[model samples]
Target: MAVEAPFWFTSLAGLGAVYLSVVFLRLLPYLVLYLRQPKDLRRCYGSWAVITGPTTGLGRSMAMELARLGFNLVLLDLHPDNLREVSDTIREAHSVQTKTVVFDLSLVGTEKGDEAMRRLREAVEGVDVGMLVNNAAVAKPGALYFHEADVERLVTMIRVNAMALTEVTAAVLPGMVKRGRGAIVNVGSGSTVAVPSFPLYTVYSSSKRYVEQLSSSLYVEYKSKGIDVQLQVPFYVHTNMLSSAVKERMLLPAFVATADDYTRAAVRWIGHGPIAVPVAGQQLQWFLAAVVPEFAHNWYRLRKHLQHRAILWNLN
Candidate 1:
């Protein structure tokens, strides 16, 4: 004769089933998004794209990818020679037009910044600029207490990461609004999104948090105007921006994505969502963080920073 299961066992099994179903439902949309075809960026947004800090890292890869997809580029950077080189390379490889704008992001909000903005405005004034990628940013070479950080460096970091992003977006958005269609992609950080507190890198994380908030508000404000504003948060992309020492010891190699890998995943999500963690693996990381307690996150992050600080000390 068959026997019925115990009451507690049946209840526990039912709870397990419900939890698994919730997890699956939460993940199903992202699974579908990953499998679907990428949008026609040029056709959906515009004929031309403007990218800041286009000479390296995520900027360089994104410029190349967008050019491959047939968008003419306006490349902006502080280094004139580097800008010219990237422009020439994209032109030669993709058979697409490229305009190099040598503008220092640090100059934004200064008198010289006014002149720089004027030049940037003039560069894209008559063109069909369908998208703007604000990818340029700066961070301290290593983690340190906020009190130990250089005041000048902190100001510069804020200017480059926060002010410059704002100014560049302002320079690009009015035109996009006039045209009534465009995409604005602000490259953000996983430090801000994935953790409760980024202890030693306080200013950097705080600046990125600003990016996240601004992007969200802009997305809502401009959605009715046919503009798509998205904040693309990436975690541990292996690029020149990361020092060799930290790259080697601080984070596991398995967790780090190459710039190309990140950008390819990044491009696919453009114009689709306001906030996106482009890599699927990073999305999983975000989910795991969500379930963990805030205190646990803070404690773990603090330990990581202390380890990072020790590595920096040895190098010095």
Candidate 2:
């Protein structure tokens, strides 16, 4: 005979099952629609994709993947030579048209921003831009206290991480709406949810939190308009951005995932509703952050922070 649990134990078990059911129901649709046909995606979204910060790391990786999927691109970044190189590489490799826009998104409200936005707008006037990847952002070097950080760099971080994404969306969204279909992927950090709190990376974390909210709200406002806006929260991509911080050689399975693998997953998940933690490990990390106690998450985050700091400083 099956043994019955005590009254409180049975009640707790029932509640746990209900919680799990709720979580699964929320995840069911994304699991089913993880990927649609590439051709169908192209037809729905369009042939052109605009990627900011396309000169290096995750941004460059995403640009290449999009080109392989048969999308023309408008690539933007502060690095002119790198931008040109990326554009030429895409053109040579994919037989796809490419436009390189050397725009400094850090100057979002200045004269430079006005000129850059004007040029960017003119550059993509007749092009069918179906995707916008707001992938450019800046972070503080090392884990420093907020008071110890440079004020100028902090301001630039806000401009690049927050304002620039917003302005670029303003520049591109109307055309997508007019075309009646498009996809916008806002790149966000896993620190927003994967960790209980970010200490030294305060500004970057807050900026990503902004992107998370912006992407979700835009998804709600535009989904019925045939536009898909997804915030991709990914963790520990082994890119230049990450490589600079640690002494050890960054490797996949050791340092989360490689840039190529991460970007490929992120690009294919463009229309996966408001947020997409594309990697199974990252999804699980996010889930743990949500379900676990805040104190537990904080302890883990703090422990990892010290380990990273030690490695970065060669103190280990």
Q: Please, what are the lDDT tens digits per residue for candidate 2 over residues 141-258?
A: 5555688678888888989999999999999999999999999999999888677698767888888999999998999999999999999987877776654546354334654777
Q: Which stretches of candidate 2 lie over 4 Å from their true place?
A: 1-31, 34-39, 244-255, 310-316
Query: For candidate 1, what is the lDDT?
Result: 0.90
Give the clash count for model 2: 0
Could you give the C-alpha RMSD of every candidate to the true structure, in order shown?
1.6, 3.0
Colliding pairs, model 2? none
> Would you list the C-alpha lDDT of every candidate in the order shown?
0.90, 0.83
Deviating ranges (above 4 Å) for candidate 1:
1-15
- Backbone clashes in candidate 1 total 0
Best by TM-score: 1
TM-score between candidate 2 and the true structure:
0.88
Q: State each candidate's clash count.
A: 0, 0
